[model samples]
Target chain A: MITIKKPGLLSTIQDLGRYGYQKYGVVVSGVMDSFSFRIANLLVGNEENTPAIEMTIVGPSIQFHQDSLIAICGGDLSPSIDGQTISMWRPIFVKKDSTLQFGESINGARAYLAVAGGIVVPYVMGSASTYVRGKLGGLLGRALQSGDQVEIGNLTELSKKVMDHLHTNGPAKWFVPFYKPINPIIRMLKGHEFDLFTDASKNLLINETFTITKEADRMGYRLSGPKLMQKEQKDMLSAAVSLGTIQITPDGSPIILLADRQTTGGYPKIAQVISVDLPLLAQMKPMDQVRFQMVTLEEAQHLFRKNETYLTDIKRAIKLKYR
Target chain B: MDLQFYPLGDQAVILEFGNIINPTIHKQIQVVSNYIEENPPDWMIEFTTAFTTITVFYNPEVLFYKEVCQELSHLLKNIKWDEPNEYRMIEIPVCYGGDFGPDLIEVAKTNGLTTDEVIDIHAKGEYIVYMIGFAPGFPYLGGMSEKIATPRKATPRLKIPARSVGIAGTQTGVYPIETPGGWQLIGKTPLELFLPNQEVPSLLRAGDRVHFTPISLDQYMEMEQTRS
Candidate 1:
């Protein structure tokens, strides 16, 4: 068990998200960066959908009450143990009564911490993710606060072996894959209402750069960029919207839906960020500028599959090393 | 009935029946939704039904896009609407006017009718649940009396109580949770529209027929007590 000493910013336990509930208008709240979240889980021998703590810009200060193995992944949040700086993207053995602290983010916006065993939280509608608005799932359907005691589930054989080997403190030999984009260009596909926008609006989408505004949160990122006006203000019925959907509000600005977005919306969507580039978008902080690049549906699907294969290969290599 | 489908993204497809909101469109949506629910593909993760459209979400790793589209097309062609779908005629107890409905008098004044007359018209009209969205179990209802139709408030309230029956322009809906909304409140219901613990959280589905039966404050308290 680990107790939260300071719940720095937004810290919540999340898995892949609740499935089979969109018809009931339930939000699928999960980790912002699934790529990093999965890697952290893999490093600790946890399942893909194992619950982990997702920290935002600022990370929480935690005190471990029991010796355990853990992995920290995603944005470089400069984590330290008892004032000693620690490395990331690899498994580390934490002794009982050890304290973990984090400072300002060095690169990205979100960080995921995975223990040897997943966090033991009650599942609501098939997920452990906390949907704050609905008050369902996770640890009482809310973010972690100071004094919260989180229990860990039973660990796997691999996790137990790793923990036993690093009884005091040490890192594993298994390496972690890094995904860093050369340019801050997000690839997107034309949405259903793509043709409804004016030609100038369409051109502006690809030509200009958009800045993520302060209004951004788990729900969506309200961008301050080119005002994309539609040809006509047609009354559109509410329809299903997914994560990465770039919706143009009545004010003409774009809002990119994220992990906790509502199931349905009535806004006109111009583009949808490709699934492969969503992790990069997730790492972007407020005031970060991003350019959009048009990609075909085929290209998007190809990229998604390629990324998945990359992760699968990494998982296989890690298991081979442990064996 | 004809069905139109297009890709929403690489992961989901939006199947639309038509652009209008009517009983025929609702029936078509219901038929397709029921068929898919009864025989869902292995790759399909979930689907959301809205007014005149249903978006089908799937896992790309398990099934190819072309194959999914082909299978959906074949299913659409084979769907038979002759079998009658279950229609739930739910009677919702509402407390209109007074404190339960702050805007009831204003809506009546705007429509040039008395409060009792507005209540009578609203109660007599036949309504159907078009979709459940905006909030969990918050039904977007159709078929409200046009006479009492009013535009939404310019400024939305920060906290509208749950189960508040409201009207905004041509649409009438109930707030299943406390949320900021611009709808003009006409009455309040004691029933729980959305409960997370239930197997099916939402009380009303897309095709369910609904009727409002006016009740007093004392009756509302009695029903609330019985449920608690």
Candidate 2:
């Protein structure tokens, strides 16, 4: 069991996301950074989809009641065990009664913490992700609060083996390097209504550097940059939108849809961020600058497959080391 | 039915039936959606249907973009559209006017009709649930009397109560959750549209037929109590 001493900013339990409910207008709320979330779980020998604690700009102060194997990934939040700073992106065996805390935000906006056994939370619509707006999943469908006691699930065989190895070997000597680029250049694919935009708007999209406004949240990041206007006003019926869809609002500013975006929207979409670069966008903080680069659909698919293979390689490497 | 496929990012594809929002396009969407739901492929994750399109989300790891398109094309070719339209008819009891419907008077005034006349017109109309989007269990309904058609409020309300029935332009819908909206409210219903605890959280779905029945304050209170 782990007790929340201080719940910082917006901390929620998340798996991949709640699926099979978007047709009913249910929002798919999950960890913003899937790459980091998967790595955190993998480091502790848990499945990629295992639920973990996702913290925002600030991080929670957690008190461990029992000795456990855990890993912190995604964003460098200056995590520490007791008073000593701990390395992230690798499995660490924490002693009982240890207090895990986070201080300065060295880089990135969100961080994920994974335990060997994963967090035990009732799944709503086949997911443990917290959809706070709908009050649907996670711990009472809300963010973590101070004094909240979270129960850890029974560890899998792999997790137990990894824990034993970590207990005997202290901590892993190496870790997956955290990746966060300042002013990242996010790659995107042309949207369905890409041709509807004026040439000037298209040029502005590729040329201009947009700043993530304060309106950025789990739903979307409202970018402040050159106004992108369409050729003509056309009434469009609401259609299905997805994560990383860059929609141009009536005011001309683009808003990149994120994990908690609505299933359907009526706004005219300009482009969709590629799957490979979603983690880069996920870790961006408000007021951060970013540029968009266009990529072909085939290229995007190739990049996605490459990323999947990279993760699989990491999984195999970790298994060999632990064994 | 003619189908057009467009990519919605790397993981999902949108199958557009037509650009117009009519019964024909809506029926085609429903037929295709039902087919996919009944016989979902291994790579197919889930789908969401809108007015004229159905977006099919899939796993990129299982299939490439071209393969997904081919599978969907094969599925569409096999679908039998000759089957009769099958849908559920749900009757909602609404208490219009007074505090339950703060904008009922304004809606009547905009249409140049009396409060009772507006209620009569709204209740008598048979509406079809075109899609469920915007909010959880919030149904975007069609087939309303043109006489009572009104534009949305210039300024949206910060917090419209749940189960509040409202009209915006030619469309009418019921709010399943308390959310900020611009629709002009006409009444409140006793039925709970969103049930988060149930296996099927939403009470309404696309292709369902719905009608509103006017109820007195006393009946509204009695029904509300029974439901709770």
Candidate 3:
């Protein structure tokens, strides 16, 4: 058990997310940075999709109510237990009732905290991730507040044994495989509204970089860049939109809907960021920069397959170690 | 009308029933939706509905695009997208104007009618649930009386309260959640659009008809208190 002393900015419980409900207009509000979330879970020997805490802008200051193992991942947020600095990308054990604090982030905006056995938030629509707009899932379907008590699940036999063995002295071996290299190139496929834009507008997308605006959140990242002009269109018929959809708003700004975007939209979608690179976009903070890379539909599909295979291989390797 | 499908992304395809949002294509969507729901395609996961189209999201690795297209073609040709309504009709009680809706006067003034006349036109007309989108359980109801047509607010309110009934273009509907919106506000409903604990979270689903009955502010507050 742990109690939040200070939930800086916005911190909410999340997992892989609620799916199969998009037809009803429910967007999957999962952990934004799945790569880091997975690594933190892996280090603590938790399931990849287990509910974890996602912190934006700043991490939480907390105190352990029970002796448990914890791992911090994503960003360069300097987390500390009590007063001493703690290393990320590794597991650390906290004795019951110890204070933990979060310091400044060097790069990136969001961070993920993984307990030995994930946080047990109520599952609404088959997920523990919080959907802020609808107020569904996690701590009354809202972000964590100071003084909120979060319970960690009972550990599996393996996690219990692994917890006892992990070091409290220093950072563990780097899991470089899951790390998103800074300045990532996001791959994208042409969206349905691709033809609606002028050829110059389409070409501008290939060349220009977009800085995520202040109007960014889990729903979508509103981008401020070249105002993409459609040859003609006063209002577009609303259509089904999914994650990674880069919708060009009427004023010509691109809003890349994230994990928590609306299920459908009326904005003209110029492109969709490929699935494989969505995690990178998810970690970006407001005012942080990004650039788009064009990829053929075949290439995007190939990358997605390749990524799934990589994850599969990693999972197999972890299982083999335990076996 | 025949259906035409194109790739939405690597994992999804959008089937265009026709350019127009007519009753014919809506039924076609329902038929294909039911067929696909009852007998899901090998690669298909879930499909979302729109006025004249259905976007299908599938696992590319599990089901190839070519295979899905072939299977979908057969289903599209045979299955009727225009099926009769399958869901129940729900009448929602709304309290219009005054504190219930801050923009009621603005909407009434723009429409060249007194607030009471606007309310009469709005409540008397029947509404069809064309689709649910934008937010969770947000029903896009069609069939508003053109007499009540009012332009959206020049500047969108930063926070339009949940259950604020509003109009955008020719469409009128209840705001399911408290969100920033540009719709012309006219009233508020006390009912919950979505309750996570409930088995069926949304109060309205696609194909569900909703009628707004004008009620007193006292009644609205009473229902709101009951739920709380």
Best by lDDT: 2
Select the stronger candidate by lDDT from 1 and 2: 2
lDDT of 1 by residue, A108-214 (tens): 88999999888999888888999888888889988999999999999998778667766634566556858766348999999999999999999999899999999
Give the alpha carbon lDDT tens digit for every residue of A196-307 in model 3.
8999999889888888899988888998888899999767778898778898887899999887878888888889988778878877877777888888878887777887
Query: Whose DockQ is higher: candidate 1's or candidate 2's?
Result: 2
C-alpha positional error of residue A24 in candidate 3 after TM-score superposition, expressed in Å = 2.7
Query: Per-candidate TM vs. native?
Result: 0.98, 0.98, 0.91
lDDT of 2 by residue, A232-321 (tens): 978788988999999999989999999999988999989999998999999998899999999998899988988899899989988887
Q: Score residue B98 of candidate 1 by CA lDDT.
A: 79
- The local distance difference test score of each candidate is 0.88, 0.92, 0.81
**What's the CA error at residue B60 for candidate 3, in Å?**
3.3
RMSD values, in order shown:
1.4, 1.0, 2.7
Query: Considering every candidate listed, which one attains the maximal DockQ?
Result: 2
The runs of at least 3 residues in candidate 2 whose Cα sits more than 4 Å from the true structure, single-residue gaps closed, are none
Lowest-sum lDDT 10-residue window in model 3 chain B: B76-85
lDDT string for model 1 (B1-228, tens) is 667778877898889898888888888888889889999977899998999899999877766567778979988877887768778899988998877788998899999999999999998877899888878898889999899998998899998999898889987888999999898999999999998888888888788899999999999999989989
| lDDT for each residue of candidate 3 in B155-192, tens digit (9 for 90 to 100) | 99999888889998788988877889899888899998
Q: Which parts of model 3 are misplaced by more than 4 Å?
A: A167-176, B41-43, B77-87, B101-117, B217-228
